[model samples]
Target: MHRSSDTIGAIAAALAKAQGELLNPEKNVIATIRSPFPREESRTFRYASLASGLEIVRKSLGEHEIATVQTTAIDHATGQIQLTTLLAHASGEWISSDWPVCPITETANPHRMGAALTYARRYALFALVGIAGDDDLDAPDLLVEPSPTVQPPEDPHQNRPIPRKSNGSIHKPRQPKPVLSAEPSAVLRDQLVAEIKELNGADDLALWAHRRLPTKNTLTAEDARMVETAYQAAVGPLPGRLDDQVTPLLKTAQKRNKAHLRFVAEQPCLVCQRTPCDAHHVKFAEPRALGRKVSDEFTVPLCRDHHRQLHHHGNEIAWWGNVQIAPLEAAEKLWQETLAAPRPTFRSGVQHHPRPKADERGASSRDSG
Candidate 1:
């Protein structure tokens, strides 16, 4: 019965191909036979035999060969045998039996079949994009293959194995030790303290003014002592006053004037009243004059956003001109207004200038009494 079915299948496959209905039917049968079998212990041997035969045929013939097969199974209740033949195409499509079947085509490149199968196993039916033909295989595709085991590069600076010496040997370079700047010794500290105490008692403002003035880069120990004493007198007993804060402030003010002294002259941001505000010069100082340490009256402290806004609305703020206005009065007024006046609801983040409220108008009328 099996031999008769095979012959009938071959004849049917040939007829289908002659009729231009089947194309490369052999691969289609191989694909069907290679498909996973259903769980039936009785059919295990049959399934294995079919798989082996399909594999052998696939090895002997190229993947493009066409074939077909027919099977007749007896319907026990009807007591009739039904015969059907299927033409299998290389593209894995099967035609005939009871209904018409669509012919499948080779959509993927044959060379990338292994890679495609690997990717399908890993990613589960993930479709590859832009893979057309042989031309699509480039350097990127070659790199996708498994690479050989690569050894790490050797370090050139590694010490070579040498014979041991009788005594421990040292190989120090004959370079002279570099001389660092002379730091104030313990003796200098004691002298500095005494001078600071004396300067504190004498004239504090003079000491402060002296510290603000710049000294030459070639200042001696005596000059450092004098500067330290003056700085201590100005700042008093504030924590980290001498070294951390005072010295840096004085140095900055001296080197680039009070404008460059970030903390000394800077106020809280005008908009947010936040500390560490940006230094914004109302007048654009010439780049050349920046290093001269000239005291300019046109600088102000503004946060980043407000500084940008100041430049954007330069014409409005320009009314103040290059005149240096002290922030103490403005800050005092703002504080007073916040306390005594009705709190004005800000529509946005900006604070509008103070205006007379209704209560203030009433109070003024009553004060006339």
Candidate 2:
């Protein structure tokens, strides 16, 4: 501890040594984090989870003689939750920073406010160290692993000082926060866009465009020609590559996934049993990038409104009427049940209508278009 009589040189030396050791990124203390709660629309953006942040401070900074403490207070003017972080040095000197928690509103429900404050705490501490995630160029965090309950710093703003036991540790149960997701950072988004553009060359792109143009069926020959001509006019002449003569078969994994989603959308909303649904891809297997998404086969069909709700407030436990179900796991189980059902065979008496009119059937209409 520093005394009023302590020499200035000793204090400076101690802080310099600690700062130099702490700033090195090469140390194993920092971690690369991929968020468990990525944006429902995309997974390209992520931030350090609270667990990861606490782990970093406890493990990384503690080793360097620094301890992080937080003081939570309400910004009365804005009525926003504020979390202030104090990075204390072993020498009894410290630096503190405070930021208002944006997601917590003045009129938010208590539960929501608690959750938002929890999220803000993690972010404030994580940022103080200048560490970053892969997507940080940023967004919102989880931990399934067991860990210690990180103690909060003494809240100086409170009327009374918080008491500590003789051992000098306090126990506090943290309310887990849900992510308030943001769009991908400009740098990461640009990198992804550049990667996609560089993925295919001019010739390949021209042929890909040509094949995508409607060349037959729901589309009249005249319509097909018009589309092809327009495509050429806009982008340029088609490449010398061969035309896609036969319609593509639904064998590729991508095709199979699309077909499964279509089939699921045909059914009633899995949550509310409502019609006209959107197929939401839930967690299954490992998470992948937006462009290399997991198949729609793992989706749960929900109405547009419910789908938005899930993206917003639906955690692992979703309340549908009197039932509490984990949407992803429930959807997986539903899919498993279908596998056990026997497929019915077609009888000779039933005639297959192979030739479908464009206006009557989607397949023909798609082809014609």
Candidate 3:
């Protein structure tokens, strides 16, 4: 949150009074957008449009000598759109908050993106003004009574007994036979050998040849091309690996920005909604070295159990893949927020930061791979 230093006290007092008297915008739009899931049901969603929300906020805050402005900008580094909501008082004091606006659909459809931006702006404005609509895009659909006419598809062979042959043996379906390819030509064999030789030394190539091609009688053209492609991929030019070496002194001097860590710890866990999380260092974000963690900027908010589970998962990159969480992108986004407006470090004697609630703690995720 940003505010004018000279008129902070005045703005605070005015904001508190305005919040007490602010009015919520009416739900003016009822939409029936289809669900992304194929099998799940969809429901009609009611929300206030951006224009309606702005009307309410302007009319309400204007009465209290306050004005508001909302704007959007692109973050060049991540190519993500950010919406900022600013509230200004007549006393020359102001405060604002920035939120990342994300599109639901993957395609670059202008209409869908505009809808996402509108949703974000409406909610951000309402949230800043201390009011909200009946529902929001971020919330899950509320449970409702199921329609009596709608029923699940019935199984055609429910409770049927297994088929048996006349010999009293259970019948089994035949499996498809594997198709074998024709033998590779001598020219293809020579090309494969050359490709392997270029990728590996003679000894390594001989070892691979012995294991994969026991005899030329078994090798096919497909097999030769497959071997050639495998060698190329194994030693080919690729994205930079995080396991590359780094200087010891440079790794040691990596900044442990307490302010960034503290800010990240305040956010809800990426897996669950539990707050007051641990700033988990995503080790794959930077080079791995003996007894060294990645810089603090590469951290994600995770609970104690998830943090511990991540460390013991054996493969950090694969573990993140299973849960569909992009730690590097998330960390970079949060770090960008800090860079836009720096947060102060924690004061002395406040070393023990707030912890998650008792109920929120120790709730291990069953599918946290």
lDDT of each: 0.36, 0.48, 0.64
Best-fitting candidate, measured by lDDT? 3
* Residue pair clashes in candidate 1: 24-90, 25-66, 25-67, 25-88, 26-66, 26-67
Poorest stretch of ten by lDDT in candidate 2:
242-251
Better candidate by lDDT, 1 or 2: 2
Model 3, which residues run further than 4 Å from truth?
A: 1-7, 102-109, 136-369
Ranking by lDDT: 3, 2, 1
- Model 1 spans > 4 angstroms off: 1-192, 200-202, 208-335, 341-344, 348-354, 357-369
| CA lDDT, candidate 2, residue 313 | 48
Please report the candidate that would top TM-score against the real structure.
3
Error of 1 at 321 (Å): 32
Candidate 1 least-lDDT 10 residues? 124-133
CA lDDT for candidate 1: 0.36
- Tens digits of per-residue lDDT, candidate 1, 1-369, equal 111332345444544344442122122221122322123222111111223333433333233354544444443322223344444545454443421111111113454543333322222101111011112223534645777988879967547554455685654446553322446344444544454455432234333234433331224556555655555454443332222111211222312334233422344554455556665543322211212432233234565645554554434223222222333334233333334655546658987655566685344323211
Residue pairs clashing in model 3 are none
The TM-scores, one per candidate, come to 0.17, 0.29, 0.37
Q: Which of 1 and 3 is ahead in lDDT?
A: 3
RMSD, each candidate, Å?
32.4, 25.7, 19.6
Count of clashes in candidate 3? 0
Q: Model 2, stretches more than 4 Å misplaced?
A: 1-43, 102-108, 138-369
Model 2 / residue 264 / CA error / Å:
56
